[model samples]
Target: MDSVRTCVACRKRASRTELLRVVVHEGRLVADDRAVLPGRGAWVHPTARCLDRAVSRGSFPRALRVSGKPDAGPIENRLKTLMDN
Candidate 1:
């Protein structure tokens, strides 16, 4: 069986490999390509819709336990890049 991790955006449990790994470092959200980041990490579906839902719903910010709204800039840009290439 695969390991499970709760999505930072959806607050739902999902397979670790099935979700994208995002890490908050230096107070900035960054996409962790290798899924190896020292600080707290957040999970989200690889799909654009999920990422959007996460951002608009405040799930990302709540899951990360950080104040202020997450602009979803990194997630959005990553999804866009994936679709473009």
Candidate 2:
């Protein structure tokens, strides 16, 4: 069976495959499409609404247990790409 994860942004539980996994890499947020990145990952829906909510509420750092603010540009770009496809 697929694992379950919670969206840090919406605070809703869903299957891991239904959410996007994000990790902090070099102080920046990166999308873990393969779910193979090293470090703690925070899951959120791929939709822009969830992404905006996550960023506005400061859920990334808290969920990933990182210090200060990690850059969200990379993940934002990734989400845009996903939306385009």
Candidate 3:
């Protein structure tokens, strides 16, 4: 079975493969569908609003438990990229 994971914004548990895992990588945050990264991770809906919520509320820093040098421009671009497809 696919591992179950939760979306921090929606508070909904979903299959790991069904949700996007956001991680901090080398002082930057990126979404990893591959689920491979060091340190902690957070999940958000694969939608723009949920992603916006996660970024706006500082959830990534809280979940990863690090002070964020948030590159939200990249994040927003990534979400837009996904939504465009």
Candidate 4:
């Protein structure tokens, strides 16, 4: 059976495969395309608006259970790059 995850920004529930998984790597947010990275993770829709909400609302840190704010650029760039490819 498929699992479900909620977007930390929008708080909408969806199938895990439908949302992008993100994790903090080296104190920065990065997308887990294969969802294989160890440690804490949060799911979000792969859209700039969703990403912006996640950043503006400052939910990443709480969702990832980490202290301090992490940069959101890398995650956004990764999504854009994925869309472009």
- Top candidate on TM-score is 2
lDDT-better candidate, 1 vs 2: 2
What overall lDDT goes with each candidate model? 0.76, 0.97, 0.80, 0.92
Per residue, candidate 3 scores C-alpha lDDT tens digits across 1-85 of 7888888877789998778888877777788878887668888878988887877788778877888456766667888999899
lDDT of 2 by residue, 1-85 (tens): 9999999999999999999999999999999989998999999999999999999999999999999999999999999999999
- lDDT (Cα, 0-100) at 34 in candidate 3: 81
Q: After superposition, how far is residue 11 of candidate 3 from its true place, in Å?
A: 1.1
Per-residue lDDT value at 41 in model 1: 75
List, residue by residue over 7-74, the lDDT tens digit for candidate 4: 99999999999899999999899999899999999999998888999999989999999999998889
What's model 1's lDDT at 3? 89
The residue-by-residue lDDT of candidate 1 on 18-49, one tens digit each, is 88887666666678878887866778888887
How close to the true structure is residue 13 of candidate 4, measured as C-alpha lDDT? 96
Candidate topping lDDT = 2
Segments in model 3 whose C-alpha atoms lie over 4 Å from true places: none
Question: TM-scores of all models?
Answer: 0.79, 0.97, 0.87, 0.93
Where does the lowest 10-residue lDDT sum fall in candidate 1?
A: 22-31
